[model samples]
Target: MSYRELIFTVPAEIAEPLGDALLELGALSVTVEDAAAGGYDENPLYGEPGLSPEVQAWDRSAVTALFNPEIDHSGEANFIPELLASLKESDFHLAQPSEKIVEEQDWVRLTQSQFAPIQIGKRIWVVPSWHEKPTDPNAICLAVDPGLAFGTGSHPTTHLCLLWLEQNGDLENKSLLDYGCGSGILAIAAAKLGCNPVVGTDIDPQAMVAARSNAEINHTLIQFILPNEDAPELAADTKYDIVMANILANPLQVLAPALVNKMRVGGRIVLSGVLARQADEVIATYSQWLKLSVWQESEGWVCLHGELLSAISNEQSNPSHIESIATPQKKRLKLVLLSLFFLVLLVFAEHLSRNSLLPTLATRIDGTSSPIAVSAFSLLQKTDEILCRSLRCINRSVSDFTAWKINSASLAQESSGEPLKIPANQSKLQVEIQNRLAIPVLFPYLELTLTDAEESEIKTIQFSPQEWLPISWQDSHPLFLLRGAPSGESIHSELAFVMPQNTAGYRVRIFYSH
Candidate 1:
């Protein structure tokens, strides 16, 4: 069977009334859209959370009404004339409607065909229920269909967040909280990827309904609740290994403390739905509790990632511990200043001696050097020498052995120091690794593999950060190496070790500890 689609160009005041009139005049359905759509002055309505536009219809509206021509009540050969007469009788002075014959088809198949399987990251494949089979059967298929709620895995913000979750392969049995979870897609994905005891919370009660339904359809054990619900997992004391909030920048900044409180110490946080321009402000807002950096950006949107290295709270947040460390740092500063003062005084004292005589000589009679005068002169010279020696020693001892900053003359030397002097039993290996990722991570282990001419591994040695990093650096900035390398930066290390015989080739590799 075929149906007739009538399109009428009507003004804002008449659009809604015309649609209602058409429905009463044997029209099967009616949908109104903007007449100037796809043109220069095209207008679109956007209703953000808790807000909506004043009028639902556009200034110039295109009202489309579907009618079954065969079931016309007037028994006329043509239904257009009869429908127009009825609308005119009802005081809807609409223009002559344009007509189109639409052939009936299986709408379910047609609608489902438009949404193919989307592969996200490595392990996730968002498959609709009607898809029947996925392109990659081994992929962790998410049985999600387009719904009224957000997060269908098609938008860039949702895609980037899903990509992060999919690529993270170490989520086994980790607790997760999907804050501001819409449709519970993230919570469901995390649960499928081995995140146990997952909880999803949103302020909207309808979101909880959609989240629960989606979780049930995916066969994942998840707890979906409103933010104020009496759930143990969402209590004030509860903390999660991973806290994901794919919310906007403004809300994220406002809820920074609340979200940080949800994370356990050393736990990771994933954020999304932030514009590229707004990324910096959001990062700075969260930096107080933890360091947040842009993990990835897509279509002018960015996903931020960070780890909560320390516990953060509103009341205390360990201020006493911070002051304790600050006290020692202040003492060190005072010691440095005192050392500089002593060095300056030593220089002044040496100037007074003038390389010939001390103040004691000026007090001597007949310009002759006495025993007491000589003793005082020697004591002043000795004190100056001691201060010079002690300060220089301190400076040299505290200097960076491998600071790797500033261009160096030694950097010109190749890895193999002088090909002629390449040691047979012992060799020096230099390794430099650059972090290509956007976010910083903990320092990785450097692995050196020794191979013979046949490419078989003759021997290998794994160097932990402690082995390759300078001892002074590790002692001074212990948390830096523990946190990770700076984003898109390089680290250099040189090692001298005993080499096994028949070592003709070598390979260098770097990776995080675990």
Candidate 2:
């Protein structure tokens, strides 16, 4: 869980290059924020937002990259000194180990300790902080506490999907597949909505543990599996009526073809986790196989729902279908040779007619438009051989034969809509959470609590098919000590100890690391 954060200031011209070099050096994640901006002529760290109090007019861009020790250390540190030495008046300092860690306890204390009940699909309650009874008029509730899983429902993307399902009405008896099931919230929701044979798959095993626990809590049946398992065969055998993949754009695009195969001919596929800007490319990837339709848009994100088009079959007639099996076509060399000879003659004649015989206006204009001119031509030139060698890291697989070609012409027009503006930081922080244990973690790992805030209470709440945990954080930590309630509630909300705020210097503990 301990990560080294490389924080430095660099000239704008070299910012991008240095960032890329660092990533190639072994950074796990790189983030660029518009810190204090000032003039480059002011100070060495010009363009950097804040000054060090000692110097007032420092203006430089601060670029920070976080690298995981699990990845590579020697590689990252190898050329650092050389790279920094090249810059004129370059100033760099490494932060102490304690300064880099964002104390989890401090975060826990800042968040107000409370859990609120969230209702999903008429019968599931994603209760986190405390256990509560489900009293909704027409819904069954299952309670669950999902920690570090993706399906918290607070994210606009997840909420949009749940809203879509809710409005779609009962999914009774419809087979469902939750692709990239993070915390297995969608699959569980499908089951609670009356869907049968609910199945979930993820690239992470932690998600499976959470999903299985969630299923048991819900008192419903759901099959969870890893992506590269016998599950594909099972899925093909029992085609699902609904297939939902809420993963990000790149992976979604790569998995589009395989995901399409999991659905019945006319089954519905719901794709979320796509930013508005990236929506078009994602849609185009699967447009040929399915009649992709815009189903819902919320919070600068979109959920595309597509119906499998019957026209897309294993036939050659479909214009969009590209067969993996190659078929060779023989060409008549004699005809090609004859065409090339004639083409050269026409080009030469056209050039002479335009340049030499163009004295008369009428004759020149008429001759300029050649009827037999070749539309396009290219020189078939050869290049010298270059020595090449390949090395494989991590997966150690040989060079893949698969070829990828980008078809720009077919790409949907990029949206010119304005970027959604997120609310500015507020003095008072409020976090509402709903969790189901059965899913994997994605980006934006929960920063559980903030420094100097009262710990959020964990309580059992009612949900469709079962009850789970809901965590809510509010208020400051120094005031209230938190611990599991002695009430022996089905689930304990709030911790039993209070952490003293580290005001002198920052200290962070990896309370939980996946």
Candidate 3:
């Protein structure tokens, strides 16, 4: 319902008591803000790691109290006089009060009205669940909803980060790490844009839960984890192609070392959730490990992008030295080294492809002439055909083959199983696979071992997406990708595998590589 709002500018010492007195005088709710906000006299209060909580309130307070309009027919004319007289008798003086009518609103609709499809760059859009997907066929729309976490793409900080992501171009086949991943927006966007193996870490379990839920909604695969004291040790073991952190300045400054250590040399780091005035302090904090500069600014928020500097020394150095090392010659040298590294990987993959060890072993298996073995071989051949067609290339000739492999480990390692529907008369068992991994797997072949009631091995057969596609009637895009298992982001294609009717149970083992 509509209400009246009474506002008073009071000294910090009197603000709390005045608010309490208003509540006792029938105010529904009372809140305080800095009277000088957004002005030359503004005072911004920030809480640091070791600071006491008592210092949180503003120095000069604008106390606002909400009251039912019917309580005082004359508005402030009656209530303000009564309130001032009571305070004075108590030896507490309050300045002149102001009143305004607050119109009643449909709060739910009002909140929803404040959010709409937010476009980032030319290719990406953040869409709320209630809205229709963007009509732009090329637009990468992320279905996000407001949740308990921090991000909704409405905040200026989030906007800045998303803009950076869009301007950076295709993240396809790259690994990304999202630190302080509230709502998992950035990580999900990266996954949609083709970044393989996106990892999102947050200190709040609620945020982690929200992030995972958002990823699932977007049909993107992202690994969300809670980072604790031992996070540094785990972070040191892995390196990312890009690292993004959209958190406040203090935490960002404190995390500089850890974030830098987790990035590959020359890899890019994107940071946001910082005010324009606080940019210099954050830049100075990270300058030790990365050469940082303001990349973009929007609505008073700034995004900083930087490249990890060479790891030539353990001690901290000046920003000038970091800048010096990021010169064109050094960048070229780094690029050359990276190219050679990938070249070695390609050669290694080629060797594996040429060996054809798995096929040879399958062909030589005992009882290959038997019907079960023959059927298994047929399934394997069919899977190979589907992979070649859908993945575009089965051999190392495809550059993405190596990238797929590198990005595979980034997918969620957890596996879940469920029974697939089948005819009651058929002596075959069908199982469905939920490939939670971030990168697509090529020709995911599963080996199933049939067992009798006595739990003794009876017969074995293999099944893959090709065999499951016709039986399961699933979409062909994800299963038949010539590139391998398509990235299981929004829709994880369930590949059905058929097994010889099991009198008892069976064991499953999946085999595939990028």
Q: Of the candidates shown, which would achieve the greatest lDDT relative to the real structure?
A: 1
lDDT of 3 at 440: 41
Structural similarity to truth (TM-score) of each candidate? 0.54, 0.45, 0.54
Question: Across residues 175-292, which tens digit of lDDT does each residue of candidate 1 receive?
Answer: 9999999888899999999999899999878888888998999999998888777888888899999999998877888889889999999899999988898898899998878899
Writing each residue's lDDT as its tens digit, candidate 3 over 9-120 gives 5657677887888787778899999765875436566564543346345545778888886765435456766767776777665434545678888888888878888887
Predictions ranked by lDDT, top down? 1, 3, 2
Please identify model 1 stretches exceeding 4 Å from their true place: 10-18, 36-41, 58-60, 72-93, 132-138, 203-210, 213-217, 247-257, 275-291, 314-514
lDDT of 3 at 297: 88
Task: Give the per-residue lDDT digits (tens) of candidate 2, residues 1-514.
Answer: 4665655543344556656766765666666443333421122322212312332222234567776555655235544444344332243222111114332245443442444677654545566645567667666565556465678676767876776777777588988888888888778777878888888998888888887888787778899998678756354556778888888877888889888888887789999988787788888999768767678788788998988856345666565544432331223566688789987775445344532221121111112222322122111000000101122212111111111110100001123211111122211111222221111111111222222111222222222111112233213222112221111112222221222232111111111223
lDDT of 1: 0.72
Clashing pairs in 1: 441-484, 442-484
lDDT of each: 0.72, 0.51, 0.67
- For every model in order, what is the number of clashing pairs? 2, 81, 14
Ten contiguous residues minimizing lDDT sum, candidate 1: 403-412
Report model 3's TM-score to 2 decimal places: 0.54
